[model samples]
Target: DGSGFLAIFIIGMFVGNQNTRKVSYILPVGEGITWLAQISLFLMLGLLVSPHNMVHYVVPGTIVAVVMTFLARPAAVLLCLLPMYFRRYSIKDLLFMSFVGLRGSVPIVLAMYPVMDDISNAQLYFNMAFVVVIFSLLVQGACILPVAKFFNVYAPASVAPISKANVGIMLNDDFDLFNYKIKRDSMEGRRLRTLQFPKETAVVAMFRDGHLMKPQGGTQLKKDDILSVIGVESDEIALNAIFSQDKPVKQYPLYAGDKIYDGHTPMTLLAETYNFELTSFEKTLTVAECMSYHLGGFPQPGDFMNLINARLVVVSLEGDYIAKVGLYLLSEIRLKEHRRKNARSGVSTLSKYGQKSLHR
Candidate 1:
């Protein structure tokens, strides 16, 4: 029986440590089964107990209770825990542990075994077990917290959990989950590929447009989307910056001869008008490779792509793909115009000074 119990415990530990992704999905069923079994066991034991017979063994039951609480439980804890260096239980902790060893109605069930076997003195033993359980439950169980506090072994209350996704398993302290609501204009229409997330961070799931979505690299995050982010403790700053709800700006079509924009003109036209060179590039790579201002791969609309001293905006998309990109040389044009204006002013000043000298 002991070997079989040990084998079952080992199997349980092995199964618990394996890939537990399915645990969240199957928790309701497992919890229901456990609750059902416990309820059935207690209900069966409740039917077998007789309250009138319990009073006969009160004196012997109290003696057994005192010995079990003060001697047996503490001795078991010291013998089992003190020898193991890894589980160094302090005196105060052991005191609290011993105080909380309340043998509830479980002993009552065990005492029934002798009665069922037609053993002599079974009635007396059962009554004693019942009285001991009542004393333990009414006294030790009630004073557990006070005993912990008196020993200074009570732990502080932990921070409340933010996620509603509850499975019965405890998570490792190394990992944590963060919840963020992508506010309007913040992360709106931005693809996951464009964002440079940290190595240890991952967007496990997202809620968008009233639907749950398992996001991938190419997935575009919309405004008001609730993201379920998982990351290590050290990556909190990076995660907050990525999910920040900054105000949105109007994205215009940055192209040549575009009538919609009043002040901002096309890059090529601006360059021609201002007499500056407009550099360009043609290449194709995965969206994952592309960044905020690069042209080696397909980029999202309104994203700036840079080249040799020129810039381009991804003006359009071809059904989840980049179709056309608008080129610009605005900075170069402004620089050239400023230099020309300075030269013209210098020349005008020289001409005026020469005319004045002639008059003098």
Candidate 2:
């Protein structure tokens, strides 16, 4: 990457072929879209506000919002959405976005400024805004799920839809994310670990129905569970091939280990073999796969003293170990001493962590 600046000559269009690079396109796209949305908002708001009879139409205003949310929204939902229903903004999605027009942090303060100025009908404006917000949230938020079900727009596990990808890493390394829809009756009741996985592969994450799963060896992949797979460079093509194989497994997987992962990947191998616990707390743990180039090596322990005996464990940078290992070793020693001294008092907390690790 010494020549990182050299790669800028190619147009962005060619680079967006990959998800990680595609985001470079998306961020600007999103900003432009946001800017456009803001511009449209100002224009529309300026056109819609009729202060002359504002107070006189408070009731009608509320009624308009209700009608818009309940009638106009569902109408738009069934029309623009149903034709290409991959995961149609379910009733919940619409309900949340439609009615939950948030005033946000700034809006609350700004709405109050008019009151401080004591502008005529300022209180009414603020109060109306507050009331509309509350109604949108209360009435709309409450019915999100129900309306989703009613419209059959609610996300179902059976559909096994592919969702948008907003994951993976760029730790001075390449992270390619892939998504695939499992076919019906193809390979249900089967575990993915036993399958033919790609070389240099690392499946760091998996998602299902808006939930993040901590995947494991026995985590059987099911139909409709959107897989968020991350792999290094070598395996990218192989992963793409597997996802597009002649016949993808069809039967929906029944076993659910709760922990999510594609175990055939290098990530699972490293995690299961090394006893290294990857946590959300640690950001560097990201390079989704096990590439030979980035072993980056084992973690090393730094200087830390055990207060009980003031015992010391010094881990050197040598032996291909991570440099920050000693501090954790010391912490572990201290924790063990604390547990031994506290026994029953702190046993519950330590025991829980131990149990969870064992499950992993």
Which candidate comes out best when scored by TM-score? 1
**lDDT of candidate 1?**
0.56
Tens-digit lDDT string for candidate 2 (1-360): 356535643444455454464465566786687688656644544453556756665686588558755777556655554544456555445544443343323344555667779899776666565545545656787886776576555654443225334334553345555665655544443445444565445455555556565443334566565566655555555555555444555544332222323312343343454345645433234222221112222211221222222222223334333222211222556666645643432112222233444345
lDDT string, candidate 1, 277-335, tens digits: 43352123222223222322224454443333343445556654555545454356753
Q: What is the overall TM-score of model 2 with all chains considered together?
A: 0.30
Measured against the true structure, the TM-scores of the candidates, in listed sequence, are: 0.47, 0.30
Runs with alpha carbons beyond 4 Å of true place in candidate 1? 1-3, 23-30, 85-89, 162-227, 232-360
Model 1 alpha-carbon miss at residue 242, Å: 19
Task: Please list the Cα RMSD from the true structure of every candidate, rounded to 1 decimal place.
Answer: 15.9, 20.3
Candidate number of the best lDDT: 1
lDDT of each: 0.56, 0.46
Can you give the lDDT of residue 116 in candidate 1?
A: 94
